[model samples]
Target: MPLTILTADRDLDDRAADAVPLPHAGADHWRRPYRPGPGRVGAAAVSLLLASFVLLSAVIIVAAGALPAAVICSGVAVLIIALALRFLRVGVWVSAHGLRQVELLRTTTLRWSEVAAVRTVQRPVRWLGLPRTVQGQALVVDRQGGSSLRTLVTDHNGDFLARPEAFERAADVLEAWAAEYRR
Candidate 1:
């Protein structure tokens, strides 16, 4: 109490106290830390356009007094819309539960216990999930017990195509989550 010196640590503490708290992924819910790229948005737009055409044809069929055909067209339009929604949902998601990778036709989830490591590596990644490969970074997940490595997210994927900084931040966040939960 005789002499109290405001050291660097104390100064940092004061600055931190005044700093705005940033939002983080919730402990209980799922979060997608990256933004969807143009490829995904374009696909969704095409899907919606197809759905609209189908719906319009359904209306025309209904006007032509073909009730059954109109109903079938309506159903097909609904299915297309559902597929578009699913396409939009395709990406990497993280939560307390684990990491989830949603593809066009399937979803894979790996628990934190099952994950050995999540790291970013430079490699040839599919360009927007196409056959054309591009030299970029990918976030790969290694499972425990020598299982096959899974590529969770790639800089060329729909979530990060042409966005290197965003990909790096997403990879870092994923690595942090894996590190926190793997312990």
Candidate 2:
């Protein structure tokens, strides 16, 4: 169905997951895909470079008769491999029904209606386990849609990844979906 848009105060509070009744955004609401922030995948390359350096160093030290040079080289190799994996581990994606949370360890999806709230907060000097963003950080979307009981999805792992600056994108998609379908 064609949708009509409104400018009412969209005051949607976040809450835990349940078979909650959907809110009424009138007849003008529409459906759209939630776009998440874009992720900059530069770390993988850096990891490879570091690994090469580590190997090169290991070779040089071994030539100089450094004891246990093989062990040191193995350590650098492991570090490089780990960093590369983490780099490949980042991403962002969304759908009409839910958002995809991508991480080094796993990926998850959350539905639209369960999105209780999306708040953009500062990434702090140290967020999750990294440096702060020059621009204010994205947001943490609370949802009861995912399989996991913990419903918070943070951008540290490209949870709402549309463009990194796609806060409005996410909110818009979430609003559109919620307007049309509720939970």
Number of the predicted model whose TM-score against the real structure is largest: 1
Model 1 worst lDDT run, 10 consecutive residues: 2-11
Error of 1 at 109 (Å): 1.1
lDDT of each: 0.83, 0.51
TM-score of each: 0.82, 0.41
lDDT per residue, candidate 2, 69-135, as tens digits? Answer: 7677869788778867755545444455565555667776656667665555565322333655433
- Locate the minimum summed-lDDT window of 10 residues in model 2: 2-11
The list of candidate 1 runs beyond 4 A from truth reads: 1-25
lDDT of 1 by residue, 47-82 (tens): 999999999999999999999999999999999999
Runs of candidate 2 exceeding 4 Å displacement:
1-39, 62-67, 91-137, 145-183
